[model samples]
Target: MTEVFFYHLQSQPLEAALPTLVERSLERGWRAVVQMSSPERLSALDAHFWTFRDDSFLPHAPASEKGAADQPVLLTTDEQNLNGAAIRFLIDGALLPADSANYQRIVLMFDGNDDDAAAAARDQWKVAKAAGHTVTYWQQDPAGRWQQKA
Candidate 1:
């Protein structure tokens, strides 16, 4: 069964938090696909990855790249897993893919400050749970550390 994790962004923006998660996924030897809802968001994320930090950057490519499947982390606006990834990250109001179980894990990150985003996450949580996926919820602390809430 796929494990679905809901990350409620409160303390920091997605750009600040996402790189760490992607790095952690790479550490676990898991390829990751980050799905967004628009090309503009995808492009921004692609550029952000290259300079998210002063010293290092996550190795990634857009799904439209020539060797997208060879990238360790792929960014796109589509639900298709171009890379053979073990994890899929849904962000920027991206809906849960119909083939949610295709990946080992599905991470749904939503802005807690956004009423619509929070509401959407709740709906996704219910759907994932109903589908028999192990679901977990996480919220950030004041210091920007994630704490599992459910």
Candidate 2:
């Protein structure tokens, strides 16, 4: 079984929140794979990870790139866990199939400002719950701290 988490982005964009969560995953000794809704987002995401912070960088590679197996973080457009990732991040309204047993956790990060993303998150919430996974919803408070809503 997988623990499915939904992160509703309001104050900060997904780009900012994703790396923070990925850092936590790395600290927990977990390899992470970020699945975008399409392949076109790969280059931009790769760049963003490298320069998201002036003093930090999240080491990552595209799934099709070389040395992916050695990367702690991977950006991809598919469900292939080539990097042996225990945690997976679903972004840009990407759909994760019902079979999530391969991963310990699956995170759905959607921008509440984007109508498509918000709608997608709602659809996925139903899918994940119907699939019998432990579903949880998290959102940032006024102070920009994470709080579990449901």
Candidate 3:
């Protein structure tokens, strides 16, 4: 079953969400893919994953030459380096769907205020629901309280 996960960036710290998401994926033995805008944020996430010796991290490098379809795709917005991993596009509160064949669960991490990020997340949530995939939303209150709603 395909699963879509969304994190609403409310009052919660992004750091607090990573471990929870990581644990959930590990518990289910799922290949997780995360899409984000800031390279610094991605780097922080990579650092968080280091705590789990069993996890592997792939940072999107971005693709070179816009028309070159044969090259490896990277998610980085930096047009100069397009030779990384596949780019995961985010829209609002939705997450772009990954290749369902390779991944069982997808966790999208993004700032709630980012318009594109939120839209992508919402789109992914709809897609997952239509596909009968489980969907979960995690958000934080202004007080730094974490809340997970499905």
Best by lDDT: 1
The prediction achieving the highest TM-score against the true structure is 1
Candidate 3 stretches greater than 4 Å from native: 27-31, 35-44, 47-95, 142-145, 148-150
The clash tally of candidate 2 reads 0
Instruction: For residue 122, give model 3's deviation from the true position in Å.
Output: 1.8
Predicted candidate 3 versus true structure: per-residue lDDT over 1-150, tens digit per residue: 645556677664456555555455445543333445566655555566555345644322223235433333233333232232222233223335435423445556667877876776677677777777677887777776557876
Model 2: CA > 4 A from native: none
Stretches of candidate 1 off by over 4 Å are none
Q: Comparing 1 and 2 by TM-score, which wins?
A: 1
Better of 1 and 3 by TM-score: 1
Per-residue CA lDDT of model 1 for 17-38, tens digit only, reads 9999999999999999999999
Q: TM-scores across all candidates? A: 0.98, 0.94, 0.50
Question: How does each model score on lDDT?
Answer: 0.94, 0.89, 0.50
